[model samples]
Target: MCPPYFSSNTYFSNAIKITTFLAQSYTTMIRATFLSILVLFGVNLLAQNTPYPTRFELSGGTETPTYAEGIAYYQKLDADFKTIKLFTKGPTDSGKPLHLALFSKTRNFDLKKLRAEGKAIFFINNAIHPGEPDGVDASMMLLRDLALHPERYPALDSVVVAIIPFYNIGGALNRSSTSRVDQNGPKEHGFRGNARNYDLNRDFIKADTRNARSFAAIFQELDPDFFIDTHVSNGADYQHVMTFCYTQEDKLGGVLGEFHQKTVLPSLYAHMQAKGFPSTPYVNAWGQTPDKGWTQFPDWPRYSTGYAALFHTIGIMSETHMLKPYEQRVKATYALLEGSLKLLGEKRAQWLALRRQTKAAVATQTDFPITWKVNREKFSETEFLGYEAEYPLSKVSGLKRLQYNHDKPFRKIVPFYDHYEAENVVKKPRFYVIPQAWFNVIDLLKTNQIQMQTIKRDSSIEVTQYKIDNLQTSRNVYEGHFFHNNLEVKAEKQIMAFAAGDVLVPVDQWRNRYIVETLEPKAQDSFFRWNFFDAILQEKGGFSSYHFEEMAAKLLEKSPELRQKLEEKKRSDEKFAQSGDAQLNFIYENSIFAEKEYRRYPIYRVE
Candidate 1:
């Protein structure tokens, strides 16, 4: 067995010096062979020594490390291990820097070089919601073990593991004991909201916070092949401790989606089951127990997994039940990470090939589904273990309230509605033109690495323009916006003039889905819905009723066609006939005096 002193920084520093001298003295081939032999020997010696315990292990898994402690531990590992590297990526809302810890067996940290060598990158994100800190602790232990015992994980040879030690640094810094009331263990945990009181998970697409923007920079840099975001579930009590939320396959679409649904998901479930941690689909059931049945949670582009899918990455969320012990949850999360790495290593070739093929196919694909709905007719039954739900009288309210009877556990077959069909589809355009005025939208597009170029000169091009016809907005605030939905748009061909600095985004690229979803006004999480184009939704100019009444009569007399349409509108719309202002306002709007920019979406599509 290796002595404890051999695992310290001094020992590794001396070892590096010896190896450097040998490499300088020997020939090229001899130096390569000698270095490989020395690396294997050093790793074996390190494996013999016990690894430094993680904060969770030290505390018996009842607590997680603080933001400072977690970063310090990773920094220590970065110093002691040759394969481990820690990088300061960008800033977060907490006024602290976000850190990325990478583990590569080949001692290579360059993502492009690894990709060129056919190595797959597996990314793990932790603590986006600090209340669910299972992944934070699990990742610390997992990475430590990987560094010490390289021989145990053959997958590291073909896969590079990149982990964001603490994603929401602000939330992690905001430690509390009373935030997650329903959670089982963990004596104390971080709050759910970050320093700015924003849920980081919901800010992926909008990127309203610095944390989300930093995540986008890291995500685009690695362009990982597989991704996992760890979380704790809050819902009805169930038998299983671990649950998973995979990116909706139909929304993922094409050969990549098929392979993920048919191959990757089943393998993960089986692997977890073999590891003695039986898992199920995320319990999306609300107002009822999961045994009754539940549909898969829809992960739109605002979510972590959903955002990853836009880049053709297979992403999953490992959600341990909130009712389970924190120790058990951490263990389950660790197992899932291990299983994912193994799967990535074994299927590296096929996964990479499929991703390439999918990107190639999407570049030329014409139609894309922007909206989706669950297909109840196409569901599969799975054996679910859940406790019986009962309505018991509440002592405080003196009314019946829902509660799960843990004593009455049962295993039964339940329908899992995993199939989703495209509710609305849109044809891909040759290019998307964005006027320079909407710089906020353009900035986010560039942040996500969507390729685009500025127009060389002012040009008038015939393009498809969308006029916002009808839409509904939430009466209450949600994520700092009046969320828009049920949108209707009318497209017309017009020769639109674009300025020299206007952005022209070509659709024939690997990020076509992202371009289509965000640029298309009707997509579920489009910028129009998120209020990026809210200025266009309101009319900047309006007619003065007293002055327009006389002008409206002159306009009506000048064009008989306008008069006929006004009469038809009055005959059909009783409200228009009853009000003098309405009649005059209608005429004023139809005249050339009305602003054409009103209710007109600025993004133009070239078909």
Candidate 2:
């Protein structure tokens, strides 16, 4: 039999014949089918029209769309295109829902099912810092082009593009012309902070904002193979319009990292160069010009690319130069996105295999690096096209200020300190036990889709515990946290009793790196450093000098070992011998009078 005709014009005739044969019994069913077909036909007709111009384009790249307008445009695309789908994933700090736009070749929106079918997922995050909206406009054009001209880009067949249209909705809504003082154009743009004035970029690991938690959910759900967080550069200017900060190779650490550094990154740079938009590594030159070499931006877990690296995803931050015209910046970002999508599509098989291998290796890996430092001895040379540095006196201050002489552009090879060595390494534990009291930490872990189990009943488990021996906290608040660093943790084997409902996170999983990095106290962006476990640093109880002095003497008399240690400390240190309170407090502390919870990191490790 011939296939049943569902075309709008043919559907009515076919439906009438069937209804007449069934004597009006099939009237309702035929009407419903006809209406559905008409709706679909209308959508197809709408899709054939000329693509809608974004606010950026309509304004000649002088302005970006408001949060509402950006969403409305995506909604329109969702209505018109069968391959495009828009989903409201979760809530943001702005009281608005976070929207994820998906463009699929098979029209399949299910990410897991698409992965099974061998389609690579490429996630593009835009407007994370609303002040830098290059990615915001570029992604809109990129996704729209993919939907309107699917055949023009054969990459769609093997790659699915997902985009977070406007990440910082609050900031996007809080638009102003004066927010980014350094930015060259875009007459108006969003602010840098969200509604709560939090920099969303640094909240990835801590997840202090609702937007971050929601992002965690979306990121874990997609588990993209290739990711890009778009932004505009804020540092020293150069001839290059676009620059990139890929996840540090040694930190990403594996065959996957090797493939990304040696194969994928070169292809992307070469592709962009061929397209007439020469690129360079992100100019991390702070307080200096590009003539001198600079180190790669170390993307610790707090940043977007760094978070993606924890999952073994190849991630890059496309940073367009802020001094460039808004139009040029947007176009450069668009070109980079196009090049990334094409490369990811072409190398999907090899990339996917590397990711799989990396994940498997992480699961069984023993030692994981928790901290990294740049290897200043090692560097790579790259052609840096930049303006000459000139220390011209400031007109207002009459003081010498470093400035780039844009009139004198030069091309010369500069050393790129792209190599990093692990400064602190940690042995992975079999499992990490988190007390129920630390609900916030546990919630974030769960949000990241880390496999966890709960203790059925109160039980004592022999585990390794960390005592926060020493650490320096930042005097100034950083991203709403008195961030801690220079950590010195002392590990000891002990029997810890965990109550019912306490979380047990295993290390033998795909999220091993994330588990280790966050749980290990020395990790640069660990929860302890973010002040999640700050309560442990303060002693809950203290001894009175007068009352404890007599008790200290008796305790010292009762314990010869304790007495000898106190005597040795006094002999070794003059200050200890002079301060009576210090002697009393030291004796009390070394005795059993001090609180066990004090200075004890709550997260326990199973070896």
Candidate 3:
């Protein structure tokens, strides 16, 4: 360029332009590469944070989240949102912290304070049977959505949601792929039994484990208006993905019962149906096909819902079908919970009033029913959607096996027998005097938070008592005890002396229903039926045939009435007539030598 005789200004200008072009090109390439990375990283972050079903689909697959994962989800929610607060109640049987994740607009987990703050409480217990882990995962997703997308769950504003993230932590930790063999699609799941191999659901009333005792404390502390325990059903295939086991209305009774039946349950079904999940009552019929008929499941205090009912809480056990895909089950469970919370929020005042009315009624009622019998004639009919079931030959066993043909779906009218009548009733006395010797029953009463006063002095009072006349005990052990059946009871009025420190359970309080149900001899699941009073059912003393021969004759002669009864028994029973020892034993049992306390119930009623 210099050789071409150009001016100094022109040469300088061409050099500056080439340098500027290179610098601009380099800067543009660097900026474009950096922006491309930012876009990719943002997409990855969005994918990771997107809530389930999307999250579950992208990462967790068809399997449920592990116990650790569930806790992490709660922890993350607490970290990310102002609405959630994470609490550790205590250590469970698995040595893991029993966690309760609370969701409220105000972020207050204190139940009493929350109630005072004008918020209705709704409690949820998940993974009760760890194998039925649908609720566990569903609950996590729900709380997340409620926090991140508050507009979606409008009902949460009026209610404080408390959830036991993993109710059966022991069972939840005992994970295996083959445990839930019947379930449709879960790579792995928790076992049914807790660490101690106990079923926590059945251990509720007994409080046999540390877990149950802790649960009792939690329940009494919260005193929630509504409670839910989630589960999965292993039964015949059906069209509906969701079903529920609500505390029986006939058993719950009074205004609370009517409210649940007429308003709460129907609204739950309607809300779920509107959300694309049709629901029904729990498939209570076990052996029978759904199209044929079904009865309401009887929930004893051993069950979670039944235990909640004693405290006048409206409890429902949500159950999803096991045959359905894991994703579908979880979604259905989430819908059920969402619907229930919405209904609870919408009718908070009515729920509060209903509970108040029930408590008032229970406080003054004189006669309370303990045992219930199904009213088969009083059933209502409903349309049932189910698959045709048949007994087909098993390919593995070469025997007829129960199978549901999902290919052949059918809908028909089915009998839904949900009504119940009190089979037995007990007069609610001023006080139930339990002797000091029955520490087992005493411990249970204390665990249930039943109000009891200890006697200060030895006192004799006229009261009604029971004598165990006959009972049939199971040969096998059930829940670490020998359960009884066919119990024959004889009531008598007696002047009984109670020592100091004896527990006096007054029936005038709110827990009157629980006291009567557990203490009354006629109640099906009473302490006596559970063999807590088994000592009363056995002969403490027996005589040898050689020693009691003369004594037997003398005893029979002393009481002609006893002799007549013995003769009638011998005449009727060939076995009694043939055995000499039987005659002697019968005479000995009738004689004064037999201890009166042997068959006498330790429980007495003071009125």
Candidate 4:
């Protein structure tokens, strides 16, 4: 690693030597011409050493740097800040390195040491959606600016910043200027899908891609206090160039939730406003005017912020409007991040205190909200800057379509219903017993860094087991997983046997929220709800209606209670009385021969 200020000092030294040599060796006119050319080249070289001066600008704004160029820029900066260390997180689906840059004055990459020194970790992720390359360029500039003038920004002293220069490596490599139709002038940028064609954003909870797996490892290792994933937004046209999505506090839960809603978010926005970048919540509403208002964007676990919230880390999805000029978007992204650093630096102690409190509190939290309902009764009114939305006829499609009329822009107060009420809150169990057979769920839990132990020997324990009563599946393929939801489960208290090596996860830990949200059947993104246990919803065995008809009749004849029930059902329902198949199916479901394990969710909980 190069020592701090080595690049700057060396550049100046080289320039002076070149100038002196040129003046002595050539005539005045020739020397002046040579000196001017040499000076221009020297400045360009120094600018390269400095950050944010992109190759695109060097080329007179005709091109953006390739993914390799972005990585190389960071690597070069690594030399300027000796404390800055670059490491390959791992190879992506495209066999390219996922590089991370960690910076600190002490050159300490040890997170524990940094924490001991009263430093917090601020993790910034860029290029998740390669088309939204604003952060990629912005982060390079931010880190360079901080390193070049460490004394100028006191906030740099409060935290150790780690940045993933380009998260979706494959997407970043698939370059195209036309991919983002609505986006303004980057000249060229990456596509949104990775090599495997997976959207890494949606693969967080599922971990379907190598990128997500690597991210999981990094996230667990750092356990950052604050995180930001940068992007560009596509929504109703608005005056605000930058907007953001923080993890919904109501879903994050406990004091952590309160702190995020009441403190961090407001501070960041306020800071942004002070910087003149006037901010707004992410425009989650589509095909609607902002003046009509919208709700907070739901940051589910699949999203970066949502995953970060599982561990009670403050995470924000920073989005620059795609309609804005690329340079303006990049600058806006840099400004938002710069403001965030200031706020974080000013409130470092409070953030660290809240971090400790929340981590400790979550371990013992009794009730974890698995689902949330919008609290329509409570809302905050914010000024919304937007163009009038109009439905205009499409000349090609011969239909009216929703669009923004930029000719009629207006700013007005609009309701931002940010409040939410918890629904289907679950009383957390002491330990969750997952059968060893369900290794899929076990692997995922482990991937999320939830601690678990294996049963030393075969044992029987009384626990509550969820029987999946009903489930719904989407007709469309989502992120390569058959998504499921609307889970209806019947919990039964019973003694269950587990084999040696069965997974035992104690819920009283920092990952309690993650545990409950995933293990519980009703949670919006539970394993059951995500179709991890969809097999349980299928019955493998069933008696033929013709063969079981005689048995059902005999059973009804033998048992007076069965006979009465059958007679009552027939009398009450004309459909059942007329349909022999329906009667036989009902009898089969009520029979002992019906598969007991069908629709039986394997995860059991011990109180």
Candidate 5:
């Protein structure tokens, strides 16, 4: 370096200058890097401005339970009063396993001790419908409040409160923000029926849950003392959040007494009233059971409350109005749970008294003759063939335009009497009234989204042909009606609960004696070879060819056409499909019914 002799040459001078420039550049970059980090910190601080923060960590459930904030909150609850079981896989649907968090004070709270101290309370859950998301939301709120403020939920020591925030995991995921972004359905709608599109509520009694298995699992494992199912009602039908107990006539529901009334319904009612929310109640008796939950479906066996009530346990089902906002529904749910817990906590001398009385009444209960509504509005009168024509969607549109200048909502049915003709025109691609409404009363069909025909019999707006068209189905809806020649019954209730397989319904025996139902049975063209009197005398739950001859004898008394419809089998366009989409590869041919009679239940009052 000494030999190079300093900056004597210009080339040496330039090299020295370049080295100095490079050093300065390196120093500047280091300073710039520090400045960038400072800006980033400030931006993040601005993003999180709330004092009490919420982070949507998992993305689909709640705004809580994220790694950054809610973990500490949940941890606080776990540390204070409970054990958190990490369901590495909460539940599975199709092939995917879902992750869930189950928080309970497990061993800390002993059921035996609670029972010894007379302070045990079980939960009845409702609110699995994703569209009516309040029950689940309220569940989380209740969990947090109880977990954080144990003193508030003092009953936790005595009561084993289970928080099943999401009953239908898949449905909830679809409705949540993360999943809603790409929910798959008709037109990408957020409303998705399970994997198979059947309402879980209706799928209870039947065991056809190829769509989901959790319903069956929970039913067997937790025979909870009280059951609650939360749902939403159409805006037109309900005014506010309502409670349904077995109707007054059904006051015979022995165990669901004052405790149910005071602890569950009153609390929910009072809570919502304080919130200025509107509500209604189903007739105390009629709506309290799954069999009477509007229309019956095969899934009565799996209904949480239905199972509870059938076993003489307490049950409560709450329905919020659709018109209410999402936040309001959530608030309502919070109020419901809070009220329920408070009621449960309060000592009930009346409940114990009622329980003793209920047991006594049940022991002596009788099968008082079941004279049902054989002549409900649908069955009040039979208009002879050619008396009225079926109404289709197109005609209803025309009526709407003519009457309200299309200002009225697209109604499923119409106004005016003898609009019956317009209501039952089966000629159109979409007929709403005559066939749909008529078929259900006879217990001949099970369908959804049917067209309604307008009937002006009652002030109730449900008289719309479009609305009446949907006769809610039951597990054995037709068991009461199959009193024809081909189908036979002998002093027993026989029903084919599940769909008849291709070789099931014993077509040949049923073919000649009774009205054989086909894909498209001709309107009013029916023949029968049975008599009504003998059919009634037989006392079979399902009808048979023997009953058909009995019904024929009834033709001599009142209704003549009833006898003729036997032996009337026509090709039908109406098809029953297990999968809602109708894309599932299944043959709807030769569904033969077993001659087997449905088992009869001698229904007796519990109290």
Candidate 6:
């Protein structure tokens, strides 16, 4: 058994060593002007000294370390801090040892300990993609901050975080050289393939290659509580904010997914949204795996968010705003990472309870026939769901018609409770809009003097809401994409910019999310559920969907196409099915994101 150490301390150790080792790693390090240590050193000092280093600078620049280098870098530092190994494995790989590093307290690694503590986060970034240096740069700062303040945060106690910081050592070595430039910039920022020209992110659903065993072993060993994929936007379209592609708004949290969504994400978003760093919240209600799922075919990554719900993990995709300075992007990203850990630590009790209940629910699924509610009002619902991720556009689209998009998101509200038997109709109490805005939309409604009441039941909590909009005011008028509005919306270079473009509108649509009709709430209540396993998340509510694991399971079971695709993965990578490659790809697609590197390949069967 591997020894467990304080998770933050483990990080502190990793950060300190990476820098310390990189400074001395080689007699002749990469000497490209862009890959200098002076910048990293200065930034490290600033982060170490400043109460808040303004922004977190993760690494110096484009220096791709060998797996041996990365491992050795941390091992040396791990010796100094409160570091302990959580697990160790040697899996089959095309060329190397499948090394997996997990740093947490000895007690914390216990499944029972995780159950008792209840909050965890994982970050994924597969190698350094020329165009997507944000994840690499940002993680450098995050690692340092954790190392610097091991005792400052108790939240690290309830949290366990993992990072696939570098996946393509070979690819990074051959990547073009330039400053934070995308493929089209600075002479050296467009290369996007790993060493073998394989995209780690796309390889997940069926990552049958040299690194397959590494991926499998890691997945089997450290099934994280949350998965975070760090990547860049497709182009310079959006502003700087994290975007999510998975949810529990549709299903009941299949044993594990419920634990993260119900207990972790809400609190995490709330803390960051409240941090005074002007930005729009990013979340989605459905699986964003267009690669498979929906479009009729449906085989998604079983180790990523698609599997998160099944395993009770909260999956996140950290897509940085492309237009922003890489330093700023990295800073915001580090904060997001830090913020997530804080939420996990603070909500340990709730998360732990949810974890237990989620597990119990899955176990009970065999006898009780647990059902999930799928909202069919998809057109309006997609628009509604779209508001969170593609808002401002959603808001503009809805308002352009001068018609209030249906408050009810979906056309059909089908509860997935009893798929094998007669389904029960979900009783709608006049209106049901699970305001995807971390429950803040509830207050927005109250600000408008809306009539809404939060009711508490034994098993689940419900909010019965009504708007009292007597005046037809344009409160939601063109708010300039939320960037220049009363609230500052951080616009990135990629995503948010897309909606605002072509529209040639009066505002940068990326600045604001869907302008939900706000009538304002007059009162509030804690509709705590006593019986259902959901009440544990009363403080962090308003997720769009749930039960990811069940979603994956049922979908895989029902759809032969999806099953066949997944089966191919099992067959091709049978020998290395449980290696570090599985874990790496899981992280690559799910968390620890970087643009060019993470999204460079396709994971779905290209058939």
TM-score of 2: 0.91
Error of 3 at 494 (Å): 1.6
TM-score of each model, paired residue for residue: 0.92, 0.91, 0.88, 0.90, 0.46, 0.46
lDDT for each residue of candidate 5 in 34-103, tens digit (9 for 90 to 100): 4346446542222121111122211222232212132344344444444443232224353333323333
Could you give candidate 2's per-residue lDDT for residues 13-38 as a string of tens digits? 13344333333335445644654464
Q: How many residue pairs clash in each candidate?
A: 0, 0, 0, 1, 77, 104
Q: Which residue pairs clash in candidate 2?
A: none
The C-alpha local distance difference test score for the whole of candidate 4 amounts to 0.80
Ranking by lDDT: 1, 2, 4, 3, 6, 5
Best candidate, TM-score-wise? 1
Off by over 4 Å in 1: 1-50
Model 3 spans with C-alpha error above 4 angstroms: 1-61, 79-82, 390-393, 397-402, 556-565, 571-574
Task: Give the alpha carbon lDDT tens digit for every residue of 1-607 in model 1.
Answer: 2113223332112334333334343453464464456456543222122245566764556878888999999999999898999999889989998999999998999899998999999999999999999999889988987887778889999999999999999999999899999998788889888999999999998888999999999999999999999999998898998999989989888899999998999999999999889888999997776877899999999999999999999999999999999888998999899999999999999999999999999899999899899998999777788988898999999999988898998988899999999999999988999999999889988998999999999999999999888999999988888989899999999998988999999999998888898889889788888888888878888978888788888998899999999999999999989989888878877899988999889999999
Q: Report, for every candidate in turn, its global Cα lDDT versus the true structure.
A: 0.87, 0.87, 0.80, 0.80, 0.35, 0.38
| Candidate 2 RMSD to the correct structure | 8.8
TM-score of 5: 0.46
**By TM-score, how accurate is candidate 1?**
0.92
Query: lDDT per residue, candidate 3, 1-607, as tens digits?
Result: 0011111221012223322333345554454354346446542222222332233433333767788887887887788788888988856688776888899886666677888877888899998899998888778877866776666667777799989989899999999888888888667889988888888888777677778878887888788899999999987679889898889998889889998999998888888889778788888877767777799889888899998988899999998888888878887888888888888889998898788788888988999887888997888776677889889899999999888887999888888899989988888889999888888788778866788899999988888888888888899988888888887889889888889998898888887888888888778678777777777767776777887898888877788999999999999999999998888878877778877888888899887
The Cα RMSD in angstroms, rounded to one decimal, for candidate 5 relative to the true structure is 21.9
lDDT score, residue 475, model 4? 86
> Tens digits of per-residue lDDT for model 4 on 262-333?
888888788778767888899888756678788998888878998898888989999989888876777688
Q: What 10-residue stretch in candidate 6 is worst by lDDT?
A: 523-532
The regions of model 5 sitting more than 4 angstroms off are 1-117, 124-127, 175-192, 210-221, 235-252, 255-264, 282-304, 347-488, 492-607
